[model samples]
Target: MEPKNQTSVSEFLLLGLTDDPAQQPLVFSLFLTMYLVTVLGNLFIVLAVSSDSHLHTPMYFFLCNLSLNDICLSTCTVPKMLVNIQTQDQSITYTGCISQVFSVLVFAYLENYLLAVMGYDRYVAICHPLKYTVIMKPHFCILLALVSLLLSTVVALMHSLMLLRLSFCTHLEIPHFFCELAQVLELACSDTLLDNVLVYVAMFILGGVPLSGIIFSYVHIVFSVLRMTSSKGIYKAFSTCGSHLSVVSLFYGTGMGVYISSAVTDSPRTTAVASVMYSVVPPMLNPFIYSLRNRDMKGAVRRLITAITSFL
Candidate 1:
């Protein structure tokens, strides 16, 4: 049932990451820099992967998709936050908030699944090297990407549709920079038992399943590496997955940290502050992690830079 007393509410006030007037400019500048770095870094990864023929394999193909996901994920939240901070307007219209939620959900879930797919790609490349080409063929890679996008779309749509059914009350101040699903749900006026249940189920299916897959893939990869006769082969195999493993640790760790922080703390502001670690940090760092650790990526980036400079 809709709340009759608060039926006229049209906008939700986002409290944002901070409320200190003195800190606003600093925050804006800091986030703007992070956002730019995140965008340019991921863009470079995408461009490098696309331009370099040597990176046309399944691993780099998935890396390109992951970079694309990182771009969208950061874009969905950072731009809005930056706009709000720069304008000093925390009010987000209902439609805008819903759109933000949907976009963020889609990209976030897609990234999660894409990381798992990358793990599986590595698994195939390492465990069954002979069949890697057959298993991760171009068509198959496309199919995996399609499946990730489709699943994420469906899940985001489900959350968005469910959100549409709920009526918000007069108290619509969200204590976060963006319309995160959990924060938005907390502001709902109606009974959210079903929404809560759905979120849990979806989290288990989306988050748990993918994390399990990544772990399983890594476990097999480790076993395979252990079986290698040459020490150099083990080192090479580990080096190849090092960047991915770091990302997975950072991504899942920050997410779990946010969840745990929210659960253990009673402060919405604290949770919001912690959320930045997951939302902003991972995307900003992923490019550096991949590029710095990878010789092939370094060469591709150099080539990309050289070509761009020559063209200019």
Candidate 2:
């Protein structure tokens, strides 16, 4: 091995979401708008959860954590992406590259686990209504959230640390918009067995664990719902879970689409476009989804709007 090869790579090229000069400004403006929406929308969720005493429950606590994670996740990638587009430079310093990848991994995985925990929360509330509070105590909810954070951090650390060690002596061009782990791994000059293993491990931890938990919770929920004697009761019970189910579907569906698209397609531009749905669409839409569908959220929004108008 050459000394030059052994030395760490200090920078990387992002390649961005596209190569078309015409599309650069369009993508830049679009993401700038979406990034602002993601931040403001999640901030609203956090505020709604915090200000509304009626919402200070285990479920809302998890939701608050979720909104926080969504904010972090979007902030991790979007600003740099916008910069790449506007500056006409697709370069990222090695430190910045690693930081973005780690932050995305951390918060993305947090959403997965938080959503799963929310499913379980709904299960307890609906299936075992008698003991919902006993089971979903404040301490338990906080602990679950903290565990999600810890788990995500550990998995991200594993991948980032391993990727950091492998010097990228050449092939600085990253395939996708951001410093995605897969794209970064593609840029490595050394053998990537370690990187590959770390990525696979991260996917398993992030995807498999939460998915399994959600499945089990839904199974129990279905059983409970089926046993209901009244149609209205069933409808009402299912309604309680409607918002959560919507988020889960959108989040996982778009996420899986990105993964499958990357696997089946070779075009970096295509992958970046597909990845946008997962990264940008859900958080941007969540506030609307919940606000339109949830009465409490609607009321909170009304109050917030009224307060602002009065101030004006």
Candidate 3:
């Protein structure tokens, strides 16, 4: 019932992204709007993909998975943060904090792996067109999705279990908007030499590995595109990757930017602002990146828009 090693800190006070009480109202409104956009955007992608038979293919199937993950990831952090802001209650229960940490990691890594998988799907569709339908059958698509979900869930469980074993010291304020791994590790009362190693090692394994997969898939895709006999053919090959390319860039770029910005700025508020690009903006934009840019998705959206308006 109680943590043995440290004084029982019932609720951790999140020293939020800023100590400037003046900015709390502004930040609350901004994040509240972003949260609504993230939810509505990702949810619409799932609904549109599911409702439209024309959109039921390997690409959209993986897309729907990404949209769902984005929604989950955003939900894990943003709403609680907004409530904490408006109520001026920067408190989170021990159980609630841990649950958010675990859920956020699960969906964050899920998006990473899912993006890589979707990249591979595009590789098949564009470079190996003749075999696209056969290779990316309905059962096969479901299997890929299930595997990504499995991996994300498994990793989240492992990391959370490791955290449970560790004890925290008196310092409980997380520097960033959400409980980032590095920030939490800094609060650990017990010897965290192993935990730090594990955390960075995970940063490399989960983050580095999927990132490599995305890069490698694109390399082969580029090579295949170049060998094409005609300009039109090359254009067609590049077009297949347009949506995925944007999503991958948005996710990794903003995430890496957060680290790089923190290295330079050394400011908690700056890091939190950069983190918003990764945690909030990407999810809000992913559906549009896919739907607005991809011709097929554009058509599907048009139909869904028409159908919804018809009922209204």
Q: Among these predicted structures, which one has the highest TM-score?
A: 1
* RMSD values, in order shown: 1.9, 2.1, 2.7
Candidate 3 Cα misplacement greater than 4 A, ranges: 1-7
lDDT of 1 at 98: 90
Angstrom error of the Cα, residue 29, model 2: value is: 1.4
lDDT of 3 by residue, 1-312 (tens): 443457465656677778899999998988888888888888888888899898888888888889888998999889888888888888888778777778988899899999989988988887788999989999988998898889888888877777777777666777677776666666777877877776787789887998898898899899998788899888777777878999899999998998899899977767877888898899999988888788877887888899999999
Query: How many Å off is the CA of 270 in candidate 3?
Result: 2.4
Tens-digit lDDT track of model 2 for 131-211: 998999888898999898999899888888888787776668886788888888776777899789767876786679889
Q: Name the best candidate (by lDDT).
A: 1
lDDT of each: 0.91, 0.84, 0.84
TM-score of 1: 0.97
Give candidate 2 regions above 4 Å deviation.
1-6
Sort the predicted structures by TM-score, highest score first.
1, 2, 3
Output the worst ten-in-a-row residue range by lDDT, candidate 1: 1-10
Q: Candidate 3 overall Cα lDDT vs. reference?
A: 0.84
**Candidate 2: deviation at residue 134, Å?**
0.7
